[model samples]
Target: MNTNYHYMRFLVSPKTADALSLRQAIQNALVQTFGIVGGSIYLDILWVAEDGNEMVLRTTKEDSTKIVAAVTSASTPRISLQKESSFLPALGSTSVTLDEEDL
Candidate 1:
């Protein structure tokens, strides 16, 4: 199958200790929202910012919206799905900062 993956940036609150937990939370949220197969298959965390407050995720275009909704509904860590765009567009912006309220 041919899949087109896009990148999404999220502003995370109360930074997690490591990427593994972050990824797991996201996947768990996805599974809860979208079901086991859909949630576990298409998402991957491409990069986690040094501060751990930001994460760039790559997911199939078809699954993007579901992933965003899943993340937004997760309350414990409070995640905000910042933007959805192609890889280059997501990387093109020079300064991407999370506001205090977003956290």
Candidate 2:
């Protein structure tokens, strides 16, 4: 199969507590949003910000929309998908600064 991978830039809630928890929350959210198979196949974290408030995710191009929907729909420690890019550098270049209110 020809897989077209894309990167999703996202801002995570600062109240997420810790990196491990945030990661778990993301995975749980993915599973909750897309179900077992789709979430397992599509949701993968490529990079995480130093502060753990931002991240770059990799997913199939076809599943990009669903990934975004999943992240945005998450309730606790809200995750928001900022943009999608085919290039990794492009995803990395755009910096998102978060404030207390933004989280």
Candidate 3:
């Protein structure tokens, strides 16, 4: 079965240089905004800049809104929502970047 996903691009403040830091920031945001349960949501990091304020990620269609809320409402490691795509099917794709808009 094909899984539907929402691709999101976020601009992280205080810039992160690595994926681990970025992931932590997002997780913190989730937990802070929605408590421990929110932290359980899986965030798939699709691509990240080697060192910058940008990164692209994916989440299940059902959790897309929750992710947005966490990003917009979180007080720690402040993040700005940049762009998001309508739910797209994740087929046999190898990778995708924020630069490409094919999805």
Using lDDT as the yardstick, the better of models 1 and 2 is 1
TM-score of every candidate: 0.78, 0.71, 0.72
Q: Model 3, 47-103: lDDT tens per residue?
A: 776676777888877887888888788765667877777543332233646655664
Error of 3 at 28 (Å): 1.4
CA-only RMSD, every prediction? 6.4, 6.8, 6.9
Best by lDDT: 1
Model 1 CA deviation exceeding 4 Å by range: 1-3, 92-103
Model 1, C-alpha of 33: deviation from truth (Å) = 1.4
Quality of model 2 by C-alpha lDDT:
0.74
Candidate order, TM-score descending: 1, 3, 2
What are the lDDT figures for the candidates, one per model?
Answer: 0.79, 0.74, 0.74
| Residues 21-49, model 1: lDDT tens digits | 88888888988888888687677787788
Candidates, ranked, lDDT = 1, 2, 3
- The digit string of per-residue lDDT tens for model 2 on 18-85 reads 56676687678779987888677645777777777777778778878876777678887788877778
Q: Give the number of the best model, judged by TM-score.
A: 1
